[model samples]
Target: MSAMVDTPAPAPHPVPRRTDGSSVPIGALVPLTRPGWVEAGRHLLAGIESGVRDVNDSGGILGRPVELVVRDTAADPRRAAAAVEELAALGVAAVAGEYHSVVARAAAARADALGLPFLCSSAVLDALTDRPTDWVARLAPAQSHGWRIYGEFLLGAGHRRIAVAAQQSVYWASGTRVLREHLAAHGGTVVEFDMDALTPSAVCDALVDHGATALLLLTGLPEPAVSIVRSVRGDRRLDGVMMGAPAGQPEFGTWAALLGEDGAGIPFLRYLPERLGPLGARVGTALRERLGEAPSFVAFEGYDTVAALADLLGTGEVGRERIAASWAGVAVEGTRGPIRFSRVPGIGVRQWAWPPVQVVDRDPAAPGRFRVLRTG
Candidate 1:
């Protein structure tokens, strides 16, 4: 994060508007480049595309075909905001899909200002808007809701002195706060180590010095997180300490691909049930074929975002008003379960209230198999 500087705005790019009445275009904001998690974006898009295919196959929504107008945010807030502006000008029925919490926050603010209905797919920051508005709704569980569950899991595991290796970001900071507050209330303590300021070995040394029984990696992937995990795992002094990633980093295949056996036994939160329902099983199979792998919970969020919208627009006019009204009026069977939005306290948008919450890890005996430890 650099200091803000005043600079002249660049000339606006001309956006081509929809000139034909062939299909209903919906805006998709995804991260397809660096700094954004491209793997997650691929899965999310696969699910949304799969949902769109299902919608069209079953005789399109309101008999009108659905079109996805995609713009890559690359995890940049400014880029996401610009995409929303362009989508609004293009006359999209609604805007949806975002994986980064900060980027989703920026897009949410822009959609609120432009009065475009937004169905957020994956980003789960609790307060998405500065104020409440009917223009925005979310499909994922709020950060506070999920992270508090993670805190409880840690306490149940008897980790009283927990340490976190963190970086500066609104999403990470919020998760840290949730853990700190929830754990403190239960006679547990949280120790903070700034990953940006210390090397991996230094973090391990500090964990030993502080007598922390557990260390949570609240940082980003592939660099500091991987390095820190390796350092701590190899340190003989910290052999008995547990490692965790409450943000669900290890839920993805890349974690096992990179860390192999070392990635096992580190618990993380995931929004999935113990067993998939009928719809979940069917969609999960389609998503696996579409993505060439198993789908993550983020992918299911994407599918549900579009599927719920299709349910709302049944045999009715497709416009901003109906989409906005879907916040309270629509009830659809999501891949996870029944999907509906309502007012949840402290969340500045319509929310699903919750998706399933689970604390899971890769099985130590079988690194590819995920073992569920607890569910909320």
Candidate 2:
């Protein structure tokens, strides 16, 4: 009976390779549970996963696989800081991926304190990278740049009286401030409306009363933006009015689907064009397969973040200091275009100096499709 006890060799326990001597671990700090931003987080996560896969397929960094450690921040600044600290404790070589600008600020501070390389994926607040830290860099263009481009578009559209439906978030506040200041400089009258405090109908009424020729819907949440658009569409007084939003959910196909006919003729700033070059097209195709829609700007930034990390960590021990040093002059082709960072004053100190951006509107005839109106 004892001889018949042929217990198969205990299946080997798959030990977690904290460091494989070949595998590089990167942390993705995204807002997976944020009330209105979960979809954005999912798309960003998908892009990150796709980027890692591509890196490994092309003979991973230093001939080792890339591993991703994802953490949710719930779109909270404090939670974002905690997530970064935990990722650092887990010995992640670097950290990337944040959608909320406020959360990105907290995470960047923690990453700097931990001496870990943190490449911000999509947070656009100007303060996120205002000062150059050896440990922190950004892949997304600053909000100021995008706002300036938006201001130009509005001016070109002959929108002299603009009303802003702004959310109460720091990102929206700062973005609207820049936009307002820019428009004022150009002799355009600007007025702000609290999106949360007023109903969509009330906001539209106020816009009409104020003789606002354009309505800038800066609510970062898609639902509120859609409601406001619908309200405006119902009001004949707003006919022929130029309505637009900043680079938020309006760039997502899901938002267009929700808006349906209401989305037509509304313009938004988009970082990536619908059509991409070779590298961008490859990432776009993968994203479409995973997300069932074209990749949004956040998704493109996520993929670029991981690709940049792989380039910085190529064939070496993952050290934060080394990664920071190597990142200073490195340039890689990104989903949007060639990605590069530089020390620029007024904007982020070590941010993507110039990322491609464009203003796009939903195609009137083609549902869920966008047409590029202007490029930056």
Candidate 3:
């Protein structure tokens, strides 16, 4: 007597393909991050590698095998530039990946010097675009694009006096500026507060004295946002008004908990939904399967960069110049949406605008988990 058990077949791996029905190894460059960031970077790379394997197995880019080259920037600006140089020295047709904007700017500059096209996965600081580095392209849209959605959400909710909390980081500063400018255009006055400007006590006083009914937090790291909320809560001024965008790691539930009732009415902005849209879902699933976790918009950006390079390689010319030429109109289905680069360099060509304003919903099932109440 035998018990029959069905074993599932393994999923097909991605392969990079060349135009002539041959396989070529596509390479990538990853940044060195601190412990936490490194782990996240690994997740992003794993997803891209998985997609590469899948692409290879399914008849790859034009028909070449995809290969990944990893380097650690150690989260240091100088080291990041060196990493890019190393990747460039390897003669990788194009390079992709880097989460931090400062790191990206350095690496992008290096890639430009070497005549290599740089495609960054995260790096949303507007300064990344202002210089117009011909070597760069980005997967994620600028915070301005997403923050406008946050401002609109607040205005739509009947809030006119809004206070803005910005971080010292490049992305935070630029985004805060854009948010303030736009809010003014919409008849809302913004009282700006730099996270570095005030202590917890001073921030609490400012939030109350400023007469702001709505709070806009623009920063990459969650620490500042958490601190601001705590200050507001401790002062007994938390009247359930808070809003923010990707405070770095992409998880806001814990931050929401710290603020408690203050977080109840708080809504964090997200350009990409975790469940993902039709186009993003496929990329997300494939990425999760590879990374053993869900992919962030950052990781999706990495995938798109490689996809763009892969398309360029499919032209049958494998030099850096040919890659650059092909890059002009390069477009691919990214985890976020369709990605394309403008010839102007730093400005991302096509960005999907689906900034979902998720209000903190206390889940009964999880007890402390925050769920999304409204998304638009």
Q: Each model's RMSD to truth, in Å?
A: 4.4, 10.3, 11.2
Q: Return whichever of 1 and 2 wins on TM-score.
A: 1
What candidate 3 gets wrong by more than 4 Å, as runs, is 1-32, 35-40, 129-134, 219-222, 246-265, 273-279, 289-293, 343-376
C-alpha TM-scores of all predictions: 0.93, 0.91, 0.77
lDDT at residue 111 of model 1 (Cα atoms): 82
Cand. 3 Cα-lDDT:
0.59
**Which structure among the candidates has the greatest lDDT?**
1
Per-residue error at 141 for model 3, in Å?
A: 1.3
Q: Supply the TM-score for candidate 3.
A: 0.77
Model 2: residues with Cα > 4 Å off, grouped in runs: 1-22, 315-318
Tens digit of per-residue lDDT, candidate 1, span 1-376: 1221122222222222333536877899999899999988888888888889998888776667888999999999999999999998898778889999999999988887777888999998998987777778999899999999888889999988999999989898998899999999999999899988999999989998999999999998987889998999999999999999988899899999999999999999989889999999999999988888889988888899899877765636445654575678878888888988899988889999888989999999999899999899
- Residue pairs that clash (backbone atoms under 3 angstroms), model 2: 62-315
Worst 10 residues of 3 by lDDT: 1-10
Candidate 3 Cα deviation (angstroms), residue 217: 3.2
| Backbone steric clashes in candidate 1, count | 0
Most accurate candidate by TM-score: 1
